[model samples]
Target chain A: MSESTAQNAGKLSDDTVPSALMDGEFLQQLRQQMYRFSLLQLDDPQLAEDAVQEALLGALRNARTFGGRAALKTWVFAILKNKIADTLRQRHRFVDADQLLRSDAEEDIVDTLFKESGHWHRQERPAHWENPESAIRDKHFWRIFEACLEHLPARQAKVFMMREFIELESHEICAAAEISVTNLNVILHRARLRLRECLENNWFIREG
Target chain B: MKKCRDITRLLSEAQERELTPSERISVKLHTLICSGCRNFGSQVDILRRISRAYVRGAADEPQREEDSGD
Candidate 1:
């Protein structure tokens, strides 16, 4: 795990936004980044676009009050996160993590992975994945990863993004998403499991 | 003896929860001999690393024009 540490993957590289807020080029660039992040987190291009616009507008409206404590990129991202949360709330897309634990259907997927004798089903056996570290450097791989993430059920994807994307600690996710610790772990475990299955099916084997 | 399925469960659980000492020993034993389980562990590790990078790299936002600024 140490050779492959990506958690807290480092802060936004450029903290400086133009002192001139609303510089067409800068906002334009920032808008695109915001939109991409929102889309990945929300998986709805239209809604993601809306969230970026709202976030930018809100940031500009309150631009004067910007105490320089946080990097501009961090500040903007903070606003965008709130916009995304609000959008998810309005859409009723937020999942109660505890509910995920009760969904017996998930157990069916896990069950199918093994035979009655508890051996790997041929299809479920882990195969040689081309070095994933190399794949991470390729821009196209991120798109494939995003596509795999989008394949997750709405609630599962949301929770997964919160813990993994936002990099919130498990306890924080439980508080914010109103899920119990057990439920949070269960959801996370499933997300990781399903994501591995998805990438294996969609990316790894396909390339092989 | 832990089955491959059992070892796989522990591998995923290790990502989110602490494994009991017995569970750790079982996984250590299984993965030591099992190439598939080791691949499984590294695959999950890969997934975790890439996901974090993908998220944080959004701050950099490569200069590609895909949206209409709508």
Candidate 2:
């Protein structure tokens, strides 16, 4: 466990609270954050919306045990993370964390090298690199990226998507993923490195 | 042992304004002298800008009240 995680764990164990009534406004805000959280995890806006609905129902039913020690948002995120995990587990048997990290690392290296060599730049410059201006026009590029992502283990993919695409705060990501701060950081680091390397060697240096 | 590449990994969070203080310092100082890290940092910065643009566009969506009327 990282120093920060150990610290967070201490804080969690130090305080305990039973239900504190959340007003309507609090609930609305909670719902919105959860919606975004789910969206980050699933990457499908509709699926994320559904996950929030399910999570909200779960929260409402379990409100009596809601500990006020942590902020309601934290508790709510914890629940939503579990819900997302459960959903993913049901849909995909398991995601191999180590393999996923390795694959991403491979791809990042490839992509980086590729870009460095100016192969992708020569291909027909993408109007936008991250999410091509026209996904249809850049379908091939996205397809390759997506295929690389699909090769990742589910948990790593989830962490990568949440941090990279969803842009969630690390603290919230830890809470949502129920991972320790160090583990979360490690996952994020591996994900970014792999993507960087992959993007460079494969897509960026395709011609090279 | 950490190398420039290893240190560069943390810059993604640093650029996102997400890294803790020590991390920010380590990544920042490393990039200053390491050409590989500098390039990596630039790439990450570019990606961050793109992500921010996408997220912002997500909000460019019409207001709830206006959409309800439509």
Candidate 3:
């Protein structure tokens, strides 16, 4: 707390970032960021591990070549992004529409949460989560959040991650997933609903 | 005012695209009195931000390797 500049150290705009990249400490930070980012994209644990390893090596060995034009993350993520794309191309992933579409069973889950008049049932209303940002700061919380995501249907999770994790534009996501703009919207909607419900019930409420 | 179900959907939709002016007003009014919807909206909003941060990988201690998302 005594050193004022220390707190601002994480900002990307700070020139110290590029210098930090060469230090062993920052390399470790870069690796964890890459691993988590890769997991969301590659989806396979082993493949994501490989991608992260390759990306880290690339960044470390070529540290001198990195231009300071982007944040350290933006640079590392670009390297890892190419790695994941290569992995996806090698494996030829599938995006199944039949599976991606909302099912009656899933709708039934949502239906039970709301009444015929579209009001929330007493049991399913959202409880206040003070300091919601802290949810990401806690590792156990992230594990619970990931478990909630794991509970979703595969295609639904895929669509959700495509938007949430990769930050793809809607039209690009729809095109990549081979679903209509409307269907993509519906899938993302349901994914958020379930995750919100799960986190509210299982994490935030318990914490509060 | 929109129903809870409708408002919930709107909060979620707001994540995907811009809300219409009417839709925006309806949500503001509904969430103002509705604690449930208000909390729901905030959580959904946080979910978007934190989920991105999670991928961006917040600084934290290492945990056991667990496979999540596909």
Question: Per-chain TM-score of chain B, candidate 3?
Answer: 0.77
Residues A17-110 of candidate 1 have per-residue lDDT tens digits of 3353435676677677788779866777877877777776556555553333224556677788888766655553345465556467766876
lDDT of 2 by residue, B1-36 (tens): 345545655765574456778777777776566566
Q: Best candidate, lDDT-wise?
A: 3
lDDT of 2 by residue, A1-208 (tens): 2344335434432123223323455456656766865775776677677677665555555554532323444555666766776565445323346654665555454355335533333332222233433332343544456565665555666777666555566766676656677777667655655555555555555554
| Top-DockQ candidate index | 1
lDDT of 2 at B45: 62
Question: Which pairs of residues have clashing backbones in candidate 3?
Answer: none
lDDT of 1 at A72: 52
When only the first chain is scored, the TM-scores of the models are 0.60, 0.40, 0.64
Model 3 alpha-carbon drift over 4 Å, by segment: A1-54, A64-78, A81-93, A97-102, B59-70
The deviation in Å at residue A29 for candidate 2 is 30
lDDT, residue A182, candidate 3? 77
Judging by TM-score against the true structure, name the best candidate: 3
lDDT of each: 0.69, 0.54, 0.71
TM-scores for every predicted model = 0.66, 0.46, 0.70
